[model samples]
Every structure is written in C-alpha cells, then in structure tokens.
Target: MNGESAMPPLPEIGDLAARQLVEGTLAPIVVLDADLCHLYVNPAWGKVSGLPASAFLGRTLGEVLPDLQRPDDVLRDVLRDGQPREATISGTTGVCSPLGQRLWRAVYHRVELPGQGTCLCGIGVEISSLRRYLDDLETAHQRLALLDAAATRVGTTLDIETTCQELVDLLAPSLTDLAAVAIVEEEFTGAPPPPPGFLRLRKTRGVAPPGMEWLLRQLGGPGPYVDVPRGIATRHCLDTGRPWLGNLASDELFQKVTVDPERTRLFRAAGVHSLLIAPLITPSRPVGVILLGRAGASQPFNDDDLVTIQALADRAALSIDSARRYSYEHTMALELQRALLSEPRTPHPAVEVAARYLPSGRSVLVGGDWYDSIPLPDSHTLLVMGDVMGHGFQAAVAMSQYRSLLRTIAASGAGVDKILGEFDRQVAQLGLDRLATCLLAVMDPGAGTCTAASAGHLPPARVRPDSDVEVLWLPAGPPIGTGLGGYESLTVRMDPGTTLLLYTDGLVERRDTDIDTSVQALETLSLPADGPLDDMLDTLLARLANGAYEDDVAILAARQRDAHD
Candidate 1:
C-alpha cells in the first residue's frame, strides 16, 4: 500500500498464492477481514499457538484468544487508519500446546482484498525463551548485589546485639517480610545451659510488618531472654544444628513449631504462609538461629533462598563467636583490675581520703588505671596513681605488678624521688616491656608538709580554702620501664582544709581536644567550700569526666584534717 490518500490498498492475491507464502514463512501469520474476524491462520500460526487453523478461522480474535485482545486492538487501529504498525505484547495464552504462556513480537499491516473492502494481516515471532532468560539474568544480578552488600552491612562491630540488628535490617522489607535472630543465653554468659525451666533464648534483633510487630513481641521481645519450650522451631534448629523450612499451609507442621495455641492463631491472623529457620553454625558449635518468614502475598522460600540465607547465617555466626570470646576476656580482665584496685588503705585518721576507679565504656577494652594508699611507719601516708601504656589483660597484669612493687619500696622508708627511681630500675630489671605513668605523694600531717614525684604523669591538682584551684607543677619524668631514672620531687605545705587530688590522664584526656586544654579545664573546676572530701571528689569528677568518658579513670583525693576537729 502507498502512503498517499491513506487508502491505496494492496493488490490482493488468490487464496492459493497467500497460502503458499504464509506456509513457507517460519513466523506465524494470520489474516482478518474488515469485521476483525479471523479469516485465515497458516501452518506456522497453528504450530505457535498449538491449535489447528480450522479452530481459529471464522472466529473473532477476542473469542479465539482473549489474551491477545490488546494486540488485536492495535491491528484494528492499523486497519482503520490504513497504516502499518509493529508492536510487542506479552502474557499467558491458553492456546499454546501446553496451555501455559508465551511472549510475542508482532507486525501488522492493512491491505485490501480483491472483492472485500479491507483486511488486517499479522506476522509474529515467539520470544518466550529469550524473555525467560533475560528475567533469570536480572534476578541473578540482584542476588549477587545483596550478597555483596551483606559484607559491609553485617558484622560491622564486635557487638553481638548490634551485629544481629544489622543483619535483620538488611534482610527485612527486601528478602522477607519478617526476620529475627535468636542467640542462646549460654553464648553470652559463657555458661552451660540451665534446665528447661531456665533454658533461655535471647532474641537479639527482629523486624516485621507494620502492626505485626506486636506478634513478633508476643513470640519474644528483642532485648530480654525467653524460655525455650519443648517443640518450638528455634529449639529444634538449635538442637539439630540444621535449617527448618516450613510451609505454614500445613496445619500440623505449623502447629508443631508454634508451641502455643495463641501464637498459632496469631501466625494465621498475620497471614504468615512460609518460614525458614537457619542455624547460625560455626566451626566449633551452633551459636544461634536466624528466623525468616513470608506473609500475605510474599513469595515462599525456595532452594535458592535457603542457600543465600545459610550464607548469611554463616557470616553472622563467625562474628557472634568472636564477640563472645572478646566479652569473656574483657570480663576476666575487668575483674582482675577491680580486685587489684581495692579500696585504698585508710592510712591515718589525720588524712581523710576518697577514691574512685571507673572502667572504660564498652567500646574500649579494660585498661591498667589504678590507685593506692600505703601507710608508712610514722603516721605518714604514701599515695599513688598509675596507668600502664596499653589495655586489656596484659596492661592489667602490669598495673598489678607495678602497684605491689611501689608499695613495697615506699614501706622501706625511701623518699618519694628514691621510690620512683627504684621502681623504674626494677621495672627495667624485670624485663617488663610495657611502659607506665605514675604520680606519688608523701603526706606527713605532723610536719604539715607534702612531697610529690612524677613518672611521665599529669601534674596533680591542689585546692586550698582561700585560693583558686591550682595544678601542681612537678618536673615531668620519663615513664617507668625506660630505666632513664631522673625522677624529681616537689614539696608543698599541707595546711589544714587543703585538698590534694591525684588522677590518671583518662580524667582529662579526649582525642578531639589537646591534653593541656583538658587539664586546664580540670584545674579550673570549683569545689564546695565546706563539702566533705568524698562529696568534693565526686563533684570534681562529675565536672571533668562525665559518665560517658571514653577511657578508664582513677582518682584519689586526700584532705588534711583540722587539729580541732
């Protein structure tokens, strides 16, 4: 057909000639009369649709294959406008041999018959296999992206709960409608599981649909531990160390895992149709179980999904195991440090004292900050504050050793400088590798005097009744274990109502600020004029290192007593 006038129709051929052309072509072809009724379908059309041409001929396109109505409408438009059109339409067609589905790209043209007014002709190619391949490729790419993201999104910290939360957040609203992680209580405390009465499961993290969170909470809230019952899916997974895939459609199987009738009812009310519980297994043992569910119209868990979830569970198990080990070591070190840093000796009634030792926050390992008070022979008192260079068990051990040696040397009648010098020599002689900072103060109430020395430590603060707080300016010395023994002492009058404060750098050190600035801030603190020594120390600590301080802190404050009191 020519473009001009939009009505120059084709030179119609005889039925034999049309049949010969259509039968020879591999692509399916169909012809329709002006009324849009199928007049002919060739052998190729019969092969593609799996229907004999007799079944299609003389029938309206919609009546023969309703799924093709939209494409047929496009052909009608081409016939009405006297134009040629090419288009692709995709959907299930019952006319196929297996009666499943097929995607097709077709070209339609308007033509005139010798006797009839006009007709529509179509040639289509099946693209079902190619479309399926493309869809599968896209799905594979998405799965790869998810696995790649899990590497960074999960296990970002050495905290078990935080890691579990990360895993749930990554999976929910993406992989499944509901996701949760349940770790054994024994994993946290490093203790054996109690009897069934105390067999607890800690739901560390979870996510669910809006308004469905209550159902998850009913199962078990995220923070607190809950008792594991006889036949719960979590219990089975943990005991067997194998994944449990459940089709919630089966009432028996669903009831077997739900432990309670109420929970079963809730599960059905929430429209949960499928579930998967994967054990978080490590090389040593199973640490926990990851529970995933699909609700409403969400797709059921398949073999591919099972493989992916197991991979995620493996990664989470490793991180949780590492955190558990670290927690055990941290607890041991903290206990040892606390034991070594027992309440300082109350040397004499003439000198009232108050001290505090706080371990670092969870993000930091326990360190070697310690304080002590040793009574000398003649009512004199020796006070010490020290911090080892590193953190964790090694530093704690070093701190305990240093504290014992210092007390031993001070009790032998050595002066403050000699005590520090000897401590340094002994630290080197013992081949102890870690360095430590220390400050020592010798107070004699009868003499009304105090002498202090330092080993690469911050200067102590002195508060007098009539004067502003002052930072004692002692000569800075190298840290112990250096064997560079030039320790010096500074003597200052110790009048009644005067308070001496000795503390570790943690009390006035922040990574974001300079050490001098933090020290100056501490030195400028205001103390209550008539407050008790403990009250005054508490106030100073509140001002300097609030509870959120990053590192461990140790402070010792001593106030000289009035002769009348």
Candidate 2:
C-alpha cells in the first residue's frame, strides 16, 4: 500500500446534471433493457422518429415501432456480445410533415445502469437531406449521359427509316417498356399539310401483350395510315407543338387517344400505366409523333421524363426532314435522267440492236451516262456511248447537250473524226467546263465496213459467229472539252454474223481491280454463238453488274445479219 500510489476516487454525477445533458443535446438518445424494451428516450428522439417520449417509454421496440425492428435487433446483439456497433438505417417516419423519408446513423453500446442492470444505449444523427441531394445529382448526370448518347446514335445516315429505328432502339428497355415512331404520310410524299394530319407507323421496338400485338400488326409494318383525330392527346400535342404525358388509369383515357374501339380495349388490356407522346417538330412544322409507354411494373412517366423525350424527338425530326428532302431530290433527278435518255432510234432492219443504262447505287445523285443509235441515210447506223466526269444535275445537263450536238453533227453526214472534232470545239466554245469520254462507231452494212473513233474511251469488243472475242486496238485520244482537238479513226472489215459491244467504263472498272485487268476481262468474255442480240446483252449485264458500283454504266450492242437472211 505504501509502495503503490492509490488512484483518486472518481467524482459522482448528480441526477439533475445527467437529466439536463441528455435533454439539451440535439442528437437522439435512447436507453433500452437487454430485452429490447425502451427505458428512456430524449426529446431529440421524438423530433426525428416523429414520436413523443410517452410513445417510446415502457414498450418493446417491435410493439412501438415496427420499421425499426431490424435496427433494434442489432442493439440486442450488442447486449449479448458486450461489443458496441455502428450502422445506418433508412425508414419513413410515422408523422410526416415535409420529409417523406429519412436516414439515420445510430451507434449502439452495452452499458450497466445503477439500478436497472445491463442495458443498450443508442445515439442517432439524421442524414436525410444530404442523401437526397446526392441522389438528385446522380440523376442529373444520368440524364446528361443519355442526351449525349442520343446525339451520337441518331442521324448516322440520310435514311428516314434507319433514323427512326435508331431512335426507337435507344428509348426502349432504357427509358420505357415500349417505344414506337410514327411519321406523317404527307411527309413521305414531300407534301406540306395542315396540323394534326395522318401518321404512319414506321418502326417499333418492344413486345406488347397479345391484344396490342394484333393491333400493331393490323396497322401494318410501315404502310397503313392512322389519322390523329381531334380531341385526342396526340393531336393536341401536335397542334400545340408540345408533349403529352398521361396515366392510363382507365379505358376512357385510352379511348380518347385512340379512335378505334378495339385499339382502346387492347391498350387497356396491355396494362399500360403511363404514356408519353412527343411531337417530332422542326422550326417549319410538325413532321410526326413518337409514343412511349410503360407497363404496370414500370414507374409512371414524370415531368423530367417528358422533357427528355421531347428533346430526343426534336433531334430525330431534323434528321428525318433532311432524309425526306434528299429522297425528293433523288426522285426528281431520276425522272430527268430518264426523260433525257429516250429509247434509241431503230437502226436498219438488217442490224439487231439493244442497250441498257444503270445508275450508281452508292448515292442519290444521278450520273452522266448515255447510249444512242442514229440511222444514217445509206442503210448504216451510228452507235454512240459516252460518260461525263461527274454526277448530279450539272453532269446530266452536260450529257444532254453533248448528245444533242453529236446527233446534229452526225445527221449532217460528218465522219467519225470530224464529229468528235466538232463536238469538242462546241463544248469548249459554250464554256461547258465538264470532261467526258466518248466512243463513236459508224457501221456501213452495204459497204461491209465499220469506222470507229475514240476520245479517251475504252475500245469496243467484237464477237464473231464462231464465239471468238477480241478488243479492237485503236489510238486513245484526250477527253472532250480539253480543247486539245487531236482525234483519230480506224476502219475494220465487217462480216456477216458479227456482233459489236460499246460501253462506258462503269461496266468494267472497279475499285478493287485495275483498269487493265478489267479491260482484259471484258475482251476475253465469252458469248453464245447463236443467241439473239437482246439475250446476249441481258446475259452480259447480269453477269457483270451483280453488286453495287461506284459509277453509272451504259452499254450498246449491235449485231449484223447475213445477207441472205
């Protein structure tokens, strides 16, 4: 006792001090016995749990608050193990004012009371507002990411149907349970219409119930048109250029949007709980509408969802409009090309003739490729094949001018060389800046001879009655409109049962093969010895033009008959 200094006895706390400290502190404090029966609770506990002290005292934790039973079990474990623990629990309060839900961080400890034996003490701090703020921030980031992805995925090409499909795929299974795109029929025809016009279902991406599936199939995959009747929510949205959000709680609401009774029944049977209809609008007018729906298992669409979907629809509208304009222009260009290249004149009865024209498939613009046959005065025929250097309206116009001038000069009885010279001079004098390749042949069946000329064009191929194929060797000249003015002609003997083929480069040229290889391939091509001229031409095109080409093609075939026949 003398060697070891005794520690000073700890000072005892009064009941008044302990009571003041527990009641004045802001943190929620509660005391429960080992049996999970609440012995005491501070005022702060009442403020957070929305319960008074009277409600908590002298009652088992499960009997007073059922939602907190899980957290109370943790305190019971602490009492048994004599070890303290800390955890966060989330639950709704009994008396809700403005806070709908709450989270709490509670620290549980086993303590020994002066008169009540062993007990569990819990102190909790509220963290609901901070948790809510974080959740909101996360949702904002997700919306931003979705918008960015939509911008990248939509409008990859100038194809209306493809763009519509892309938009539908993006919204389904991510934003809604079902997604569909409907476009105006007038929009496809390139016609302007008043508001609330008919819409055609273009594409869909989701599975519906049996009833809704039957209705969708009846509307046609991409054909049938449905009118947006007055008083319907979709029509109102289109007329006002706004989005419509509704809860499909009753058949009456579904019937208001759908004109057919069967459709109304089908929609209600599908168990759709929420609907969003957004108008596909541009600065000029509304093009169509996009419909999205959620079934019973999914959450209803809110204001945020409506705003996001409307923005997506706006982007898709601009893409579709651009594609429609391109389609209109393509149709016009095709018609113009067809009108310019009328059927070739029937050559003399002694010669059999056939021709074909094929435009490039990679783009909408038409190219400058033409073929013609003019009957000369002396039982002869003049065959012409040419290709302009570029595509589009300008190339087509240049092609027409070249063909017209060539016919005018040839009709005056000009020879092959003179015709090429005159056409070159006229093209330069007229200030036509485009370049072209041309091959001209004058067949004189009466004289048993043929005269041919080249202007940077490929040589013609000849097939004899014995199935012998050969490419005529001639001096190549510069392309027309170059103003160089150097052209030449070759004369070859024409025999009975001999066929000649003249074509543009597109027939033989390919991106993966060289020009020389393609020319050789064409020169060695086999043809039936006794086939008709039309049959031979069809066979050649079918064999060569099996896939998409980078340029336009024009081919003319002429066959000479026996004198006796």
Best by TM-score: 1
Candidate 1 structure quality by residue, lDDT tens digits, 1-565: 0111111233553455754575677887777887777777767766665666666766876676676635666777897798799877666554543324577788988887766668887888988788878877887788788888888988877778888899899888778899988787775465456565545777788899897888788876344776777677778887787889996557667766665655677778888889898998898887888888899989798788888788878888898878767777767766777787778888788888889877777543667888988888788889899999988878888888888888888878789899999999999999999999999999999999999999999999888886368888899889999999999999999777888899998788888899988888765678864678778877877777655677888899987777787
Clashing pairs in 1: none
Clashes of each: 0, 0
Give residue 232's lDDT in candidate 2 (0 to 100).
78
What is residue 375's positional error in candidate 2, in angstroms? 6.0
User: For model 2, what is the error of residue 395's alpha carbon versus the real structure, in angstroms, after optimal superposition?
Assistant: 2.7
Best by lDDT: 1
Task: Say what the RMSD of model 2 is.
Answer: 7.6
- Show model 2 residue runs off by greater than 4 Å: 1-15, 32-39, 53-64, 67-84, 97-99, 112-119, 187-215, 218-223, 343-364, 373-383, 408-422, 425-433, 441-452, 458-474, 482-565
